[model samples]
Target: MYCNHCGANQPDHAVFCSQCGAKLQTQSESTVPSEQEIDKEQTPVDYLDQLRSDQSSNHTDSEPTLPIANKPIHRAEPASSTVSVPPSGSPPYRSTSPARHLTWIIPTVLLLGIAGTLFWWYQHQQDINVQVTQLHQEASQLALKGQYEPALAKITQATTLRPTYAVLTKDQTMIETANRIHTKLETVSSNLKQNQLQPAEKSLITLQKALDTRKESIFEQEKTLANRNQDLLAVLKVKKELDQLDTIDALAYKLDEVDRLNNQEAKEVHQLIINKIITISMKNAEKLLQQNDFSQATAAVKAGLQYSSKDEKLLSLQKRITSEKEAFELAEKQRIERAIQQAEEEDLKNRTAGVELLNVDTQLNEYGDIEIYGEVKNVATKPIYSITVYYSGYDAAGNYLFSSSASVEPYDLEPGATGSYSAYEYDWYEEVTVQIDNITWYLE
Candidate 1:
């Protein structure tokens, strides 16, 4: 038999539990199905009779047992005599309580439930990690495409799923800042397009300040846009100034700044600037050329060529100027030569009329002026337009002291006609010797 309290093995007739030492109950003979006990349902009289029979047979010191709830139980005293044994084949007493069975059952159930809960928690965390990872990948892809809002949305979802991740938190902040800057850049661009210089400048300055002060890293595209807008502003200003100007000097002066931008707009502006310079230069040079101001024309062409050396119009104008200037110089040379030849031929044809200095005299007048007097003979047959005798005066030592000139009376003279002339030198020199050096006359 198993002990009821401790589940320890015991003999069939054990009066007390061996492991716990508690009083053990015997099985009621009537309770077991048997042929001998016919009064299975005992009346009150029979129960009383049996109790009196047990009381008369034994004198016991054991305490009376209390009745179970709503059931009457007969108590048996400890036997001093030998107890009767049941049949040898009868089953041993092995009753146990439901409460005892629940000890192991409840603990087993609790252990199983705890294990299930732990396993479920682990799987839940894994699922969360996977979700967060997928969200991060989506965010990254969107961010790469410059879709910051959707990317931020994904990151925000991830943040909600895994709020403890500091990396996610940082990513959220960075993306937020980048998106703000991007919006600001768009505003700046719109302002620039509308020619709102003040607002555009303010936006750019604010954006740059944010970039400078922000701890998170900004995107490269945002930085590039900012810088591009700055250059665009400067380029627009240059183009504005250039458009207002009509001179090559002003337009060409901004070419350097235009080149520095090196963007599409700047390249277009640069072409325009060069074209303006070339056009104005060509026109100015052409005007100067028409005026026969070759020097200034050459200067204008040179200025234009500085901007565009390969310009076809400027080159053509330059070539024309060269050709025209050369032709003019050649023509002038030929005319001068013709004039000299004609004058010489006339002089040779009229050589028969010779000039003579008859009654030539030089002396100091009483007014302290040195006087030179002479009579000129027109030794030519043709009448001269005007004749003047030029002479140099020297001292008695033959050193040049002064020079004098005089015109003969009766401006035109016939062949062999005589004319008298007198010249005075104001500066005093000792003992002057007058020598006639050259005479000039015009033959018209």
Candidate 2:
């Protein structure tokens, strides 16, 4: 039997636990009657009467014989007197406390439960690792296929399972990077397709910069593709700008800005641009010439000449503008000369009608000198205050004569006013005539 208090092994008849000094049983309670004593006993009533008679007889003694205490029990072999072996036919003593019976049983059940829990936990952890690994593999495959969204979802799930796992972490980063790159590429492609070159070029440049830090095989190829797309975008931009050009100056400016002429197509397009510019400039120049805007026409032609100085149409237009300008100048000069001539004729007529001589006489004076006199009048319906009279003397043969001049008496004349003039020439004698030469007069 096990000691109740300390669970130490002990004999069944032990009065006190050997390990903890706990009482196991009283001496009287531990003792069992011998089967021979039971057989020799009278009937049951007689035995009870005899056990009472003995107890009364023993109590009657002043000190009843102190019953000797039972001896300590042995571990394996014990004397029949020390051990409390029940009589051969008597039933064995059995414990009635449930707690006593369950002491060993409960621990065994607890141990089994703990072991089962540990095994299940290990299996669960293994399953989790496998699932995470499988998800990582799937994500890698999807990323390779360029299905980044689904791949990102898978990678996220795997990473959640093992946040500190190295392979999963790397895969997550790779997938995220690939997804970003794919997004940028799509944006660039869309912009390119829509002719949004500047934005597309910007995105491509950003993508190139991002790829510059990586050594991935695909990233390198993408970098190359980005560069090619950048070139293509530049070309397309140039071509678009060229297409929108409606004038030679604008096209020339755009051409100067473009740097991709080495491309065969760009070179051809450049040639076409030159031709178009020259043609448009020549046409504009022609229009300007027709409008008599010679300066603007010359400017337009020179603009075309800057692109193709030897182009036939431009040169022809330039020559035409020059010819037209020269012709125009000549016509203008002729017009001015005609105007001047007409003005001169009208002035001569006006002067002629302005003054006249009337009542003029010329004779030889007493000294045989020629004397001339006249009344000068402003015949222009205006007053006259001043006039000059001219006199000439000649022989009766009317040969060339000496001429002299004299002024009227006053210096100023009113409209239609008359002024007198007399001149005596003492040099020659003979016929004399008085004639009005010019009148200085003012209108009334």
Candidate 3:
């Protein structure tokens, strides 16, 4: 008997091959034979060759045949052929069959192939995990920097690496919200700087609402900054209102408002206001000073100093105004004195113009008074209504002794008419000389 699969020789009673472990075909289920039934004289036949002889004997030209791993000894296409038989009593041909080797090799190859595939799958999964984790870290870093758009991009790209990862969707939503808030915050800051109070206020309100809805602790700092900027926006609103006022009162009121603000931006704006006040004050006061308006100029300097009391330019301007005022007063006083003196000299010339002194004599009278007599004639075309004589008496040494004035006897002297004039001085002089000094009259 033989094994049908590997063609191994076996004992006559053996029901299975010893070499290939293939089951042997037997007449019936039976026990192993005794030594009397052992066919030691009989030779074994190769089961593979016997299978081919049977296949050839049953071969038909029209019947389809299946191929085994190894080619069969007979072609199914040939319908008839003489079956070849090995010589009797020669030890039955024993050879290793390809099926015998393939029995274990196929299973080993399938196992190795399965192990390699699993190892490759595991390594690929590890790489995807590392890449996804790296993307998550980069996205987190970008988010911390307020780079919300880039963070979103990085996290969204992580979805490409691991599309089934549901965590990335949540991260996308978070970064999107942060990006919107960041944009609004920037808008608020820009509006504040440009003095757009309404827009900035609106943006702040929106930001506050968003933060409140989220109630996220991460946005705490942004909320704090928004609140702080809101205060500045209020101050800027006041400043804007103040800027529209053209009156002196409004400007002064703005100076008063400066004390109320405590923010750094507000302080900066307040400083600008102070500078504007000083600049405007200096210009106004300087113009007034040029016009010699000392009172108004002083008021202008005071208006500037009311806000910034220690400003150097204002202080210097105040001193300049004071000095200018003093100099102006002194100059005014001298001018008035000179004007009065000129008026007096002009009046004197007008009064003495038409009077002519014909003769002037002085004598010591018995009463011890010095007497001066002068004859005055009208020298102009108009008549003098009343005549008066003025005299200056001189001593022999030519020094002035006294002045005497007296009305002439004929009060209504016609023009070109002679009139007698006399005047007496209480003191007497020896060898006196008198001259008519001036005559005063009203024109008729």
Candidate 4:
């Protein structure tokens, strides 16, 4: 028979063709082989094993011979038309069926897909690491700047990017530490403003422990708190001194002593001193007003007003001083006028009738002032309103030193009424002369 693969002539009973290494066609296969006839041929696995055995045998030694079966070989079925047999005398032909190639292609493609997937996952992990590192750096910088909230956000992002124990623990520690320091700083600031010195100091101490004191702003805050505490202490000391002081001068001196502190709190203390000074000055002014020392009272009020011109208490005190002074002056003027009128009436009575000094005397008192005293007798027909005794001082040699006058008591002296007259001169004189110079007489 002719070989079906290469059309070469072969023995009619040969199971495989020698020229093309293909199975020979038999009459039964050519007509239509039954299932039993098709099963008699090698399966695809056996075919592939034969190919591998032939390849190994070819490289080591002379080609190994195939096991030729004694039964008649059969032609492939029509369904295997796509299979192509190798040429005559070629090495054992491997299968060329489409299904055979698909097996290799599927495994190759699956292996390449797995390798590509692993490479992509590695790259993604690297990117996450880089992102997490960047977040950590940003968080650290923000914390240094005292931006605690933003820093915590960055740490949170980093932890989310890489949820490992290291990342989570680092984030928790960083955020808590920064937030704690920030809270303490806020507390310290509030306490300072409210004048809670002891609490502020304690908070400041806690903040300092967490912060780097070398920074200028942090150091400045620490110094400011310390100085504020010191200033308050000094103010309290001054207040204690002020409480012990009894005089306006001493209070004023104490106020001046605390003027060296110049902070905002110190400014408040200074204002307190000013208010106290105003209060003391006004109170003293009121006391002096009670004593009718209008000049001294005015001086006190004016002194207080100089420090605080717009103070209502000082203004009111000034108004009182002015009113009282004017009233005092008016009353004094009326009294002096009445005394002068009486003196004129007495002078007229003395001239019309007759008045004389019964005696004149002079002596030095303990105060080194001279006292010249005498008596007068009223000889007028009606009562006399008043009388004046004029006196002149002289040295032992009789040279006039000074001259003055005195009024007699019991100004409304009746006819034959005698009244006493006395006068004091602040001088060291040896002798004094007395005479009835004027008289004031009035009818009741």
Best by TM-score: 1
Candidate 2 local lDDT, 192-271, one digit each (tens): 76888878987887888888898864355456557666766766787876767897667877676554444554566677
Against the true structure, candidate 3 reaches a TM-score of: 0.44
Off by over 4 Å in 3: 1-101, 186-196, 212-235, 244-268, 276-310, 321-444
**lDDT of all predictions, in order shown?**
0.76, 0.69, 0.73, 0.68
lDDT of 4: 0.68
State the lDDT of candidate 4 residue by residue for 313-402, as single tens digits: 889888888998999899989989988887777666656655656787878877778888888887765666757666667776767778
Model 1: residues with Cα > 4 Å off, grouped in runs: 1-101, 163-167, 244-253, 291-296, 342-444
- True-structure Cα RMSD, model 1: 14.2
> Residue 151 CA error for candidate 1 (Å)?
1.7
Question: Worst 10-residue stretch by lDDT in candidate 3?
Answer: 27-36
Cα error of candidate 4 at position 280, Å: 2.1
Per-prediction CA RMSD (Å)? 14.2, 18.1, 14.6, 17.4
By lDDT, who's the top model here?
A: 1
lDDT of 1 by residue, 1-444 (tens): 655456476687888777666565455532333433433424213334454444434433453322332365555453432234446445544324344455457787999999999999999999999999999889877876679999999999999999999989988888887898899899888888887777888788878876776544347678778889988887778877876889876786788888888578888889989999998998899999998899999999999999899988889999999999999889989998998897687577565234656666889877777888888877675776477788998877889987768998878877778888888887584568889876766554
- Which sections of candidate 2 miss by over 4 Å? 1-179, 192-202, 228-253, 261-303, 306-316, 322-389, 392-404, 407-433, 437-444
For candidate 2, what is the TM-score? 0.36
